[model samples]
Target: MDARRQGIVEVAARLLRERGAAAVTIRAVAQEAGMQAPTIYRFFEDKDALLDAVAEHVFATYVAGKAQSAGDLDPVADLRAGWHTHVGFGLANGALFALLSDPARTRPSPAAEAGAAVLRARVHRVAAAGRLRVPEALAVELIRAAGTGVVLTLLDTPPEDRDPALAEEMLEAVLRTILHDAAPVPRDDATALAVAFRAVVPTLPTLTPGERSLLTEWLSR
Candidate 1:
């Protein structure tokens, strides 16, 4: 957690992302951190240990940064704010994103559980508030899976080619899939949007860094 240790982890992640994990040796990480290889060995036992640390550091940084921008509104807004951060962070840090997403890395880390807890709480709150009609646990799973699908689809396209129209197309597809019923139910506090947004936001991750930025901007405004 010290500056030098943190720096080493970050430099290692950059290397792991730029090169593959195999390419990130102690010597390489130390070189990037401008420290001697022995210094790294003091903090990390071996390549595997360092790799684990790097993975943890990346997820922690991401989650911490995201928690900052999440405004303390209702559960629906909280869910949307978090999704936007997740998608944006994933897009901008795709290499780190892919690495952390590997099941091997996640199995040993608490990061995944932390995210799950946040999702569970969000879903539970929305359901309790009557903003979401689905069961809390089921809602969390459904929203997470749906959101992952949306993000993966958007990320499959090149970022440079991602325009607003393309984004709108994706959003519309997502809306249709989740909000399949047309009949009106009693609206929630934020009007129809409270219902619509809650139904949609938790099911998707932030698809791009731009979307994440938009959420932060919205929070600020």
Candidate 2:
């Protein structure tokens, strides 16, 4: 993006943070950006377009920091790091986070999708390590739901009353559901192994398509 467009987005984002969604009008952004409303229109078609741009800008900034801080020494550790970062970001940017979390907004912005993609990759790593006890997509969804729900719950509570361990506890609860526990008993180990194999079935090249499909159906049953 050009400097002028970037400037517009930055100004709008500031207004959004300071005054919430209703404050981010084109005229208001134009005044903040020191540009005319028509000039703002030249860059964005309407208020929703401008808000989407602001979301993308804010989300990209947050995710860029996450990408830098995320390391691969251990996939499970990396996943936990990501969960903490997500919860922190949402708490820090409540307005923008609300925009992204609203289910009424059926179509996710690019930044939201980018964040989901990062989570998907992390879950894939866990699956490849044979630590995941559910399908990769299901694990991703569970984590996403848990993180978002935890953030929203905290946001609704008074800061003085908020439990510091709520985020960690929620993450652990979801992890128990999606991950294989260490040193399981024989019967539990069998179930975990089956789940892990089902997760990797799509990548097995040795099996014919029909055989793969049959195995998948049986495993699902």
Candidate 3:
């Protein structure tokens, strides 16, 4: 990408993180990026277009980084690793995670959809290798949803209820819902699952668009 285009995306991302999506106007982004609104138009079709680009920018960074680090062997291990990364990243980046789970932003941008395609491919690979009866789309959706749910739940739990055992139980329950029919499923795998465990859950506060926007600024920095 050109410097100007990248600048627009970065500025938009920061604004979204600091001001919520509602505050991320093209003119505002242009001003933040030290460019004219027309200059932003050179890279984006409109404000919606720019929002999508920002979403893609964040999501692609994650997907690319994971791809570089992931090993293709052991479908189950790959699945676990992917889940671990998802949950870990979400918890660690509470603001970004909340932004991602926002119902308003749920419709992924083209870039985010492309990243999701990569996730779908991995799901298919695991299902094929295991000869699991899961539909590719359903598996992909379930995996993503389950991971998000786990993070959200953790973020919602009371401090007193954050016992390690409780966290483990919650994560296991989530996986059981999806892998309920898997024959010869290993109990150890279920027990060792990261998303299923409760001890280190995130427990983020209720977030607003402003908080998420702040996260964007923090992330950009």
Candidate 4:
């Protein structure tokens, strides 16, 4: 993007941060960017385009920072770190989160998909370590559903009345449902073994593609 287009997006994101999405009109963005309304039109076909760009611009920065901070901690510990980061980002960016989360939306944004990819990576590690109790996709959904609800509920509450421990409490509850207390090895639990086996099926040595697919099909069931 040119300096002018980037400037317009930055100004619109600033408006969202300061005054929420309703303040991000083309005329308002133009006034803030020191350009005319037609200039914003040249960069964005309509209000929805401009607001979507603003949402991407603001969220991609937070997602980039989270991606960069991934480190050498234990996978489970790292997963907890990710949960805290996600909750913090949601609380700190209520308007952008609201816009990105659009309750009526049929699909997720590219930016949201990027964030979900990060969570899936984390769950994959836990499964690879033989600690995941559910299928990887199911674990991802559990965390995501709980995390979004926790953040949105907290955001809807007055800060003075909000429960400081709600986010962590909910994370623990979801983790308990989806993870084993330790990596169970050849234990009596068929489900955990199947989940862990499914995690490694993609890399199983010397199996034909069909064989791998067939094995995974049974394990996933």
TM-score per prediction, in order, is: 0.63, 0.86, 0.65, 0.93
Q: Compose the digit string of candidate 4's lDDT tens values, residues 1-221.
A: 89999999999999999999889999999998888999888988988888778777877877787677565678799899999999999999998888888776555677888888888888888898899988999999999999889999999999899999999899999999998887664499899999999999999899999999999999999
List model 2 lDDT by residue over 10-121, tens digit each. Answer: 9999998999988999999999988789999898998878888999998887788766655544878889999999999999999999888888785778898889988887
* Candidate with maximal lDDT: 4
The TM-score ranking, best first, is 4, 2, 3, 1
lDDT of 1 at 34: 88
Error of 1 at 66 (Å): 3.8
Off by more than 4 A, model 2: 68-71, 183-191, 198-221
Give the alpha carbon lDDT tens digit for every residue of 181-208 in model 3: 4544345553323222221122335656
Lowest lDDT block of 10, candidate 4 = 65-74
Model 2, residue 218: distance off in Å is 6.2
Worst ten-residue run, lDDT, model 2? 182-191
lDDT (tens digit, per residue) of candidate 1 on 96-215: 555556666525546656666777766555644555544345556766666555566666778776653543354444434433233343554244334434444444575576775565
Off by over 4 Å in 4: none
* Candidate 1 TM-score over all chains jointly: 0.63
Better lDDT candidate (1, 2): 2
Counted clashes in each candidate structure:
3, 0, 11, 0
